[model samples]
Target chain A: GFAELLREWESLENEYQNTQETHQLYRQKLEEVSKLQESCVAAITRQRKRLKDMSPSIRKCKQTMTSEEANTMEEIQALIKERPNIFFEMEAFLPKKNGLYLRLVLGNVDITLLSKQSKFAYKDEYETFKLFITVILLLFAFTCQFLVSNRIVDVLFNFLLVWYYATLTIRESILISNGSRIKGWWVFHHYVSAVLSGVMLTWPNGKLYQMFRNQFLAYSFYQNFVHLLQYYYQSGCLYRLRALGERHNMDLTVAGFQSWMWRGLTFLLPFLFFGHFWQLYNGLCLFRMSQLPECTEWQVVMCGSSFLVLFMGNFFTTLTVVYHKFKK
Target chain B: GFAELLREWESLENEYQNTQETHQLYRQKLEEVSKLQESCVAAITRQRKRLKDMSPSIRKCKQTMTSEEANTMEEIQALIKERPNIFFEMEAFLPKKNGLYLRLVLGNVDITLLSKQSKFAYKDEYETFKLFITVILLLFAFTCQFLVSNRIVDVLFNFLLVWYYATLTIRESILISNGSRIKGWWVFHHYVSAVLSGVMLTWPNGKLYQMFRNQFLAYSFYQNFVHLLQYYYQSGCLYRLRALGERHNMDLTVAGFQSWMWRGLTFLLPFLFFGHFWQLYNGLCLFRMSQLPECTEWQVVMCGSSFLVLFMGNFFTTLTVVYHKFKK
Candidate 1:
C-alpha cells in the first residue's frame, strides 16, 4: 500500500520540477517584454500598411463597403494589441507554471483507505466498547457452562452467542461505515459466527448432542476466555495511548502490543492451535459416525466441516494480520 | 472519494501559501547575506570568549577536562556558522515559496485506499475467470439432471456443486491474497455453498430428496444462466475498455456499464428475484413439513434457513454494490 503512495509522490515531484523549469522560462520571456512589444508594434504597422495599399485597389474594384465592414480595419488594429495580452493572461492561469502546477501535482495523487495516515475517528472508544461487551459476555458464558450443564443453560449460552455476535456485526458495520480500519473479512467473521450459533441453538437434543455436548461447551469456554484476555489487553493499550494524547497512534500501540504477542505466543496461541486441530478431529469423528450403521446424525458432519472452515479462516486471518502488523 | 482528493488539494494549496511566505522571508534575509554573516561571526566570538572564561572555573571543579569540554570553544565557533547554514539547507529542502513548496505540499498529502482515487488492479479478470468455470460446471450439472433422473445423477450434480464451490473458495482466497476488492463475505459465501453442496451430496435417497430434486436443479440452472449472462456482458465491457487504452478506467466504465444495468434489470433481475423468492418459499415449505407429524426431515429446515441466509446476503450485497456504483 505504501508502494502506491511512494509512486504517487515520485510522479508529483517530477511534475513540480517540470513546472518550476517552465516557470523559469516564462519569467525569462517576461523579462524581455518591452522588446517583444516593440517587435509586435512594428509587425502590426507593416501589416496595416500592406492592407491599406490592398484596400484602395479593392475599393476601386468594388462599388462601396457594406455597413458590416465599417469598423473592420480599426477593430483589427485593436485586436493586435489586445490578443497577445489576453494570451499571456490565459497561459498564466493554465497549469504549465505557477499556480497551475499545484493543481496538476495534487490532482493525480490517489487517496486510498489503507494509505490513510490520518487519525481515525472513535477508534479507541469503539475498541473499548467492544472489549467491555466481550469481557461481560465471555465471562457470563464461561461461568454458565463451567458451573452448570443443563438444556436451559445450553440454550442460554447459545442465545448469548447469537446476541453478542449479532451485536458485534452491527457495531462493526457502523465502524466500517465511519471508515474505520476494520476489514470486511472481520465483519463477515462475526456474521458466520452469528449464524453458526443460531443454528447450534436450533440443534435438536439427540444422541449426537449427548456425545458432543461437553466437548463443545469446553471448547467454547476456552475460546471466550482467550478472547476475553485479548480484548482487555488490547483495550488497555488503546486507553493508555489515548490518555497520552497519541490519538493518531491508537491503532499502532506496538510496545504494549508486544505484550499481547507474548501472551498469545506463550499461552493463547497453543490453545488456539489445539482448538483448530480439535475442529479437524471433530470432523473426522463425525465422518466416522456417519459410517456407523445406527447413526442418524449425518448432519453433524456438515456442522463439523463448517466449524473447520471457521477455525481455519480464523487462524489464517489472525496469523496474516499479526504478521502484517509485526512486520510493520 | 473525489471529495477526499479535493480536500487534500485544498490543504496542499494552503501549505503552499505558507511555504511561499516562508520563502519570501528567507529571500529577504539572503539579500543581506554579508550583514548576517558579520553578526554570526560576532556571536561566535562572544560565545567562544564566554566558554574560555568558564573553562578555568570548570577545571577547578573537576580533575581533568571531560569529553564534553574537549571541543567546547572550537565546536561553539564552528556550530554558530554551521547551524544557520544547516537550517537554511533544511529549510530549502522543505516546502517553501519558490521551489521547495511543491515538495512540502506533496510530502504531506496522505493517500488512502478506500479514499483511493487511483485505478484498481484487474479484479474483474479474475472474477470473470471464476464465473466462466462456474457457468461451465453449472451447465454440465444442469444437463446431467435434465437427461438423467437417477440417484447417481443426483450424486453427480451434488459432487459437481461441491467441487465448483470449493474451487471458487480457493480462487477467491487467491484473489484476496493479491489484494483484489473481493470481500470476506464473498469468500464465506463460497465456503458455505461448498459445505452445503457436500452435505447435499451426502443426503440419502429418500422421499425428501425426491421432493426437492427437480426444484434444486431448476434453481441451479437458472442461477448459473443469469450469472453467465452477467459475466460475459461485464467481461466484454472490461475488454473493450482495456483495448481502448483505458486501463485505469477498466473498473469505472459507467457509460458501457449502463448496458449491464439495463440487461440485469430487464432480463436477469426477474430470474434472480424468482430464485430469491423460491428460497423463501422453500423455507416456508420446510417449516410446514417440520410441523407435520410423520415428516422426519428436520434437516431441511436448517438447509432452508441457511439458504435464506445465503439468499439474503447475496441479494443485499448485489443491491449495495449496484446502488454504490449507480450513485457514483
Candidate 2:
C-alpha cells in the first residue's frame, strides 16, 4: 500500500512538472514574439520618419535645380506627388496617429488597424452604419412630413440627424487614418451637416419654425432617397472596381459624386442635381425667414448660411467631377 | 551639355534604384514579421483553447476520483482557479474580442492593446476623463442649486450626466476588453447611472420636479466630491502598488470601495457610506413623491427604483469588501 501511494505521488508530480514546463515554454515564446513585434514596429516608425523626411528633402532639392533641370525631373515630380499613396501602403502595419478631431474627442487613444482584414472590416462597418442610418432617417423624415405635427417629434428627428452626422464624421476620420482614400471635402461635408442639424435642433417651436418645417422634412426625405440610390450604385461600382483592381478597397460611397464614380452612374446625376437645387431652395427660404421682422432666433441666420455653404460645396464639387469626367 | 544631362540621368537612376531596393527590403521584412505575428497569435489562441479544456478535464477527473484522490489534487485545483490570470498575461498581445455592450454599440471593432504602454496610457486617460467630468458635474450641480433654477439649465445638466455616464460605460467596456481588471458590477453601475440621468432629463418642469430638483442637485454635488476624493486616493494607492509590483498597471480607479482599497483608505469609508445613505434618502423622497396624487410622470417611480438599486448595490458591495478585508 505504501509503495502504491508513492507511485501515485510520483505520477502526479510528473504531470505537474509537465504542466509547469509547458507554461514556462509558452511564456518564453510569448516574450520573444513580443520583442520581435516591438522591433518590427520600431522599424516601421523609422521607415515612416525617413519617408516623411524624403518629401522635404525632395522639395528642397527641386528648389536648387535650374529650370531645365526641373523640366528634366518632371517624372520625379509626378512620383513625389504620388508619394502619399505609397506611404500609406507602406505604413499598413504601423499604428495610426489620430487626426486632430479624434485627438480632441478620444484623447489620443490608439485607433490603429493592425491588419488589412481589420481595416477592411472597419470600412465595411462604416458603410453599413451609413446605409442603416440613411433608411431610418428617410422613414423618420417621411413620418415627420406626413404623420407628425408635434414639435417633440421634429426635435427628435433633428437630434437623430445631428447624432448620425457626428458619428459619421468620427467613423470617416478613423477610415481615413486607416488609409482610406476619402477626399478632404467629404469629411468636411459631414462636419457641416452635423452643425446644420444641431442648429435645426436648437430652433424653437414657433411660427417661423412651423413655416419651414414641411419643406425641410420633404427635402430630407428626398435627399435620403437619393443617398440610398447612390449608395447602392456606388457600392456596386466599387465592388466591381475593387475586384478588377481599378479602385482601392477602402474607397467609400460618398454623399457627393467623384470623377471615378461617373461610369455607369449617370442615371443618379439628375437626382443628385435635384437634391443640390433643393438645398439651394432651402437656403433661400431660410434667408428670407431670417430677414423677417418676427425672426429673432440666431439659428435662422446660422441655418441659412450653413445651407448655402452646403449647397455651394455639393453643387460645385459634383459639377467639377462631372465636367472632368465628360472632358476625359 | 549632353554629357551633363547624361550624368544627371545616371545619378537619378542610381538614387531611384537605391530607394526601390530599400523599399523592397522593408516590404519583405514587414511581410515576414506579419507572418510571424500571425503564427504567434495562432499559438496563443490554441493555448487559450487548451487551457479552457484543462478546466473541464480537471473537473471530470476530480468527479471520477475517490474522495482521497480528490483531496490529494487540492493544490492542482487551486492552480486551476488561478489560470485566468495566467491566460490573460499570455494573451496580452492578442486582439481582444468585444464584450456584449461594445458589440451592440460598436459592432465588433478591434479594441486590442498591442503593447503594455498603450494599455496603461489608456487607463490613465480614462482616469483623467473621470476626474475632469466629475469636476464639471460638481460645478454644474452647484450652479443649479445656488445660481440657476431654469428648467433648461437643469435639463442641460441632466443631459451632461447622461452623456458622461454613457461615455464612461463605453470606455470602461473598452478597458475591460483590453484586460483592465474592472469588476463587472462597476460597469453595470455606470449603465444604471446613465439610465437614471436619462430619466431625470425627461422629468418635466412641474411641481414634483421642483420638489426633487434641489435635493437631487445637492446629492449630485456631494457624490461628485466623493468621487473626486476617491479618484485621487485610489490613483495614488494604485501608483504605489504598481511601483511595488503589488498591483497590475492597467487596474482602474472605480467609484466604490474594494477589498484591496481597504489599506490606508479607512478615512474614505464614512464619506462613501454617507453617499450610499444619501442615495437611499433620495430614493425614499422620490417614492413618497410618486405616491402623491399629483404625481403623473412615470419618471418619478422609475427614478425612485433606480436610486434604490444604486443604494443597495453600493451599500452591500462596500460592506462585503470591507468585511472581507477585515477578516483577512
Candidate 3:
C-alpha cells in the first residue's frame, strides 16, 4: 500500500505540474492575440450584425457567378461588415484623449501582407520511427501486457503512448492545415485520435507538451523507411525468379526496415512506462509504508483512495485501451 | 479557488518509478505478422444487412453471376467497405505500434529516401538564415526560459517568451527531427505578428501538434507590455492603438527577442509557475476576482480543454479513418 501510494503520488504530481504549466502558457499566448475591448462591445456587435444581413445570398443567380468567386466575395463582404464593428471595438478601449490625432492616423492604415514571410515547421525522426514501431509493438505489447499485467510494463508503454500521441496530434494538425479531410467516415479517421492526447497530456508542467514536440531527426529514419517499404512493395521485392518480370532496381529496404524498427519502439513504451511506474510504486511503497511511525488512519485511507483513483482513472484507462487493442 | 480545484488535481507523489526495462526488446522486433487476424464484427453485420435486402434488385444481381463469383464479389465489396474502418481504428493504436509510418520504400529494399532525411537542408540561403538566427537561439535556452522575469523593461518586452517556447517544446522536438513551420499573424496597426518557424519538421512529430500544444514558454513579453500600458488605456493595449498596422516587422522582432538572464541561475520553475499564479491570484482578488483572471483564463482554459478532448478522442476516430483512406 505504501509503495502504491508513492507511485500514485508521483504520477499525480507529475501530471498536475504538467497541466498547470500548459494552462498558464495557453492563457498568456491567447492573451497576446486577443483584440477584445469592453467599451465598443455593444456598438461593434450591432453594426457588424447589421452589415452581415446585407450580404449576398449563397445560392447566387446561378446566373453569372462561380461558387468559388461567390465564396470569395462572401468572405470579403463578411470582413467588410465586420470592419466597422471591428474598428469600433478597437476604438472603445482607446483613451478618449490619446494622441487623438495620432489615433486617427493609425486607425485608417491597411496592414495585410502581400506575401507570407515564412511557415513554421518542426521535425522528429525518432518519434516517426517510434510511432511506427509503437503501432506494430502496441499490437504485440497489447497482448503481452494483457498476459502479464505488470504495472511497470504499463508505465513504460503508457508514457510512450502519451508521447506517441503528442507526435500524432502535431502531425494531424499540420495535415488539417494542408486539407486532410474525409467525406463522412470514409476519411475522417485523422481528426478523432488527437482528442485522446488532448486529454491524456493535459497536465500542469507541460512535460507531455515538451515530450509531444517534433523530433524530426529521429523521425527522418521513419519517413525514409516508410517510403522505401512502400516503394519496395509496389516494385515487388528482389525475386530474380526466371520469367517473373523485366526487373528494375528494387530499393525497398528503408521502409520495411523502418517499419520493423518503428513498430518495435512503439509497443515498447507501454512496457517501459508501466515497468517504471511499478518499480517506483513498489519499492517506494514497501520501503516507506513499512516504516511509518505515526500516521493517522484517515491519512492512510485518503492515500489509498487516491491510489485507487489514479490506477482506475489513468493507468486502467491506458491498460484497458491497450488491452482491447491487442485483443483485437 | 473552487474552480481551480476542479481545473486540476495536485498529485501527492513527486517521483516516478523506472519500470521501462522488463520487456525483451527482441520479441517486439521478431513478431512476424503472418495471417492477420481481424474481428468479424463487420462481416456479421454485413450478412445481416444482405439477408434483409431481399428486394427485386438484389434478386436480379444474384441471378447474373455464379454463386462462387457472387460470393467473391461480396467479399471484395465488404473488404472495400471495411478498408477505411481498419486504417482509422488502427491509427489510434499506431503510436504504440511503432511510429509514424512515413518512410518511402525504394525498389530492391536497399535504398530509402525520406523527404525529411535532409535535416536542416543547409543547402539553401533562406534556410541558412533560419538556422543562424531562430534555430541557434532555440538550442541554447529554447524560447528563453533561461531568462527569468525581473527588471520592468525586460518583463515588459517578454524577451524570453520566444526562446522559452522555441526551446522547451518546438525547438527540442525540431532538434529531434529537423522539421518546422514558420508563419505569422498580423495584428492591427501595421503590426505583423508573424507566427513562423523553420521547417515542416518530421512526423514522429509535426507543426500541427506544436500549434495545438499549450505550454508556458517563459515570461510573457506581451503581458508585461500590457501591464505597463494598462494605465495608458483602460482597456489595455488593444484600446491604446488607434489603427494597428500589419506591415512593419517590429512585432516579429519583438516576439523573437528573449532574455534568459536572472539575478542568479535559479531554475525559476516554481517561481515562474506557482509563485506567479499565487501572486496573480492575489492581485486579482484585490480587484473583483473575476476581472483580470477571466480575461485571459478563457483562452488558456479553452486551448487546454480543446487539446485534451481532441487528443483523447481523435485517435480512435483516426484508426478507422486511416484504414479506409489506405484501402481506398
lDDT of 1 by residue, B43-153 (tens): 444444544454454445344545555455345345434443433322221112211221111222222211111223324535555686677768676676677777656
Stretches of candidate 1 exceeding 4 Å from the true structure: A1-205, A237-328, B1-214, B234-291, B296-328
Model 2: how far residue B163 lies from native, Å: 3.9
lDDT of 1 by residue, A38-109 (tens): 343344344445444544454443345454443553454454455444333222211121122221212222
**Candidate with better TM-score, 2 vs 3:** 2
Best by DockQ: 2
Rank by DockQ (best first):
2, 1, 3
Q: What lDDT score goes with residue B248 in model 2?
A: 54
User: What DockQ do you compute for every candidate structure?
Assistant: 0.03, 0.20, 0.01
Task: Point out the worst 10-residue segment of candidate 3 chain A by lDDT.
Answer: A111-120
lDDT of 2 at A308: 90
The digit string of per-residue lDDT tens for model 3 on A115-197 reads 11101111123234444554554443544334654323332333344344444443433322222231222112222322222
Interface Cα root-mean-square deviation for all models? 24.7, 7.0, 31.1
Ranking according to lDDT, highest score first: 2, 1, 3
Two-chain DockQ for model 2: 0.20
lDDT of 2 at A70: 72
Q: Chain B alone, TM-score of each model?
A: 0.55, 0.80, 0.21
Best-to-worst order by TM-score is 2, 1, 3
TM-score of predicted model 3?
Answer: 0.20
Here, model 1's chain A TM-score works out at: 0.53
Q: What do the candidate models score in CA lDDT, each in turn?
A: 0.53, 0.72, 0.31
